[model samples]
Target: MNRQAQAVILLLLGGAVLRASVTDQYLNYVKPGLRGFLIAAAVLLLLTGAAALWQGMRTGSPAPDGHDHDHDHEHGHADDEDGHGHHSPRVAWLLLLPALGLLLVAPPALGSYAAGRTGTALTAPSDFAPLPAGDPVRIGLLDYASRAIFDQGRSLGDRRVQLTGFVMPGPDGTTILTRMIVSCCAADARPIKVALGGDLPPGIAGDPNEEQWFEVVGVYDARTVKDPVNAESIPYLRVVEAKAVATPAEQYES
Candidate 1:
């Protein structure tokens, strides 16, 4: 490809990595195991760039083809122009950096920031049909959070619940929040805030205002009512045990 195009590619790759390093919000779109793909792509980009630069550098005078072949070459000037247009190297491979970022860390959809900012707790129904009851019910934090705002989460009143989300620390540090999954865009992302209500677990409690995916498996410690909005005010799903785990995508379907 041309030097101009190659230059653009080099800049874009560096920009994408910089964004990924700072943005944990993009955890959804990414799948696990993406390091190998990125490394290979980066190496290929560098090699192609080097080759293009070499071609540009080697534009010295062409060798003479035996005396009077000049007339024959005059018409071929058009061919040179055509070759430059058609055979100019393409920097398309440079796009692989952003692609790798998408595969590696497909950002999580919008989260509580949007919800709290708008004074909304993600849209939920008056009730969710029956959550398949199990010995120790494995529920999602988003499910609990959505239900918390609707006053209909009695379905899980005293049952054991399993939730996976990130920690949102409380003031006391005695308890930490576990948030759940959200798909689609962050404009509607909602976090189920379950307070881990037992002895302090290992690791620093999560940053309250950030996104920290975890797995908090515990029994529902009864529900509590918060500042209700109109007739639809749900109760919180208090938990007894919360073990942090990486976020899962299947928890919240778009």
Candidate 2:
């Protein structure tokens, strides 16, 4: 790639980052707290690219060749007869593909396909605090999983809880309610799953589709099952009610 092309790539990459950071799109890949850093990095890249391009234009820099003609001339050597100077590897241009994808067609967050292939991430056992007072209190999948698996659902008690996540087909044609939890970004995301039992609620009308988002009301079930992929014990939720729902704006739990 030539210097100008390199600069353009920088601009494209910066624009893609800025576009994601300025909207909810960034949430699909990373935690909410990293927005400021992403914006800062994007601005830096844009400024650097702009400066390089401006300098090249103002100085009327030579061809895309990786050489400085004026310096070569001062050294008493004429420009290359072939008019082709050593250039960056052509493979570098491939970087533009991902940049373009981010700009024009950002990928969706990880869902059931990812959840089914990975083992659930369970935190080390710890004494969990009491769940807040509410019948069917809204709770995160990770929190519920940790409490149920490591803490044996002691903190859950008889209170009904609500969870929202995409559905994943589980062993023996069962359903798994899942959410991806990321420590940094999507690349490191791990599934937090709760096996769903009992009939679908009236609002759903049918078996939940794979990757379909749903809001489920249920009480923790003591029964556990092995995750087919990794044989890890997955906790269960006895569904009292469930309904199809749109994917949430922030799909991952940080």
* Candidate 1 weakest lDDT stretch, 10 residues: 225-234
Error of 2 at 19 (Å): 0.3
TM-score attained by model 2: 0.89
TM-score per candidate: 0.47, 0.89
lDDT of 2 by residue, 1-254 (tens): 55677889999999999999999999999999999999999999999989877865655456479676754553342225435553456789898997899988899999888887899888865568788877879989988988888878888988899999988777766688899999999999999988898777543334557777899999989989899888889899999988899888899987
Please, what is the whole-model Cα lDDT of each candidate in the order they appear? 0.49, 0.84
Measured on C-alpha atoms, candidate 1 has an lDDT of: 0.49
lDDT of 2: 0.84
Query: Tens digits of per-residue lDDT for model 1 on 1-254?
Result: 44545645654564454444344433443322443454556566556666665654444225475444433354356457775333343456656667466546665455444333322245667657677768667655566666544545466656667766555444334234534334443334444445555444565244443455556556555444332223223334455565556555443433
